[model samples]
Target: MILKKIIEMKKVLVINSSARTLRSHSRKLTEVFVNHWKTTHNNSHITFRDLGTENVPHINENWIAAAFKPETERTGEEKEALKISDIYISELHQADIIVLGTPMYNWSIPSVLKAYIDQVVRVNQTWKLNPENLKNPYIGLLENKTLFVLLSRGAEGYGKGEYNEHMNFQSDYLKTVFNIMGVHNIHVVAIDGTSFDPEILKQTIQNSHQNVKSLIEKELA
Candidate 1:
């Protein structure tokens, strides 16, 4: 008899932050990525978070106090305040790969996604602040994770050195935020010109789907 080693399955977290449901291009991108990933990683565990429909409350002063205060010393109200944040953080911690799909709203991310970001980027949880080094204070805690940013834009030319590069706040902001959380292995795929002609939009979406498939093969291989 021959002994074989069994490999553990990876955990993937998928976040969708588009306001549109049936008509959301970003959601379509995520669906494509998830389907392809499933085909490649048959046994992988996937967790889905739909910020478009689900309401992730914006962090208030109570949340700030709860997050900043020591866990042992937190009051009942403070603990309650951080309940949602804790849940979001737990999901992030368990995920080996994160897939974020969102449309560029007003040249940036949706407010709901921003709220989710605020919830997860907690001090002493996702990252730490080095007091001695003011210049380089942020120390990310969630290390060795892969992030896939699938973006949908109404207009084109948002890549590096592109015509509308300066106007792109979506990709850069997301990359920076995840980088701060210690996710260095990042892959971005954007489906641009969503507001173009029907045929052009369809082609662009197809290209993005192919790109996602290629990326999965290349990155996961």
Candidate 2:
């Protein structure tokens, strides 16, 4: 009889994209995720990247040149331009799960999070483009990576058939971006109405805790 090998604890990378450090609803929900994860998987390790404090730099001409150039032919400055990107990509590569704690800003994600994404999604490294296939030209390299997104909104009715369904660009945008990166296993938990309605905000947060708890349990189990 052959014995099946049990799965080991997973590496979790937490990316905090909230600009507000002290009083951020997204950050609060993320804490719930992290705490629950730690409790469930005692042996698992956690890596953190707080975009609120460590703002990622946007990709520039030097970065594009370095990324497109062959590894052996890159100059010192070109290599330097890619150093931060390399670090961010390295972190992404090592993680089995990624948690993004983000607050919706003006119906979309914060600029810092976009900057973070730009740094890691490198051409010929993280993904590849095939112009011949117009329908599906890009191929993502990262496989089996899962994403957990905690979104905090200012108002209510952002869900399907809700009052503000068309105004929700945050979750939809993230889904597209991660799908492009080859991550199809995505889970999103939203807590809206923090500033719009007090009662809705309270209830949403309460419901979000339950959702977050169940998500972690499912992952660990």
| TM of each candidate vs. truth | 0.94, 0.93
Model 1 quality (TM-score): 0.94
Across residues 1-221, which tens digit of lDDT does each residue of candidate 1 receive?
A: 11111112778899999999998989998999899887776577899999999989999888888887789988898899899999999999999889999999999999999999999999989999999998878999998788999999999999999999999999999999999888999999999999888899888889999999998887754
lDDT of each: 0.90, 0.86
Clashes of 2: 0
Q: Per-residue lDDT of 1-221 in model 2, one digit per residue for the tens?
A: 11111223578899999989988999998899989877766577799999999958999988999999898999998899999999988888888999999999999899999998899889877788989999988887777888999999988888889999899989988888888777889999999888876776788899998899898777655
CA RMSD of each candidate after superposition: 2.3, 2.3
For model 1, the superposed segments whose C-alpha errors exceed 4 Å read 1-8
Clashing pairs in 2: none
User: Which sections of candidate 2 miss by over 4 Å?
Assistant: 1-8
Show how many residue pairs clash in every candidate, following the order shown: 0, 0
- Model 2 misses residue 30 by how many Å? 1.1
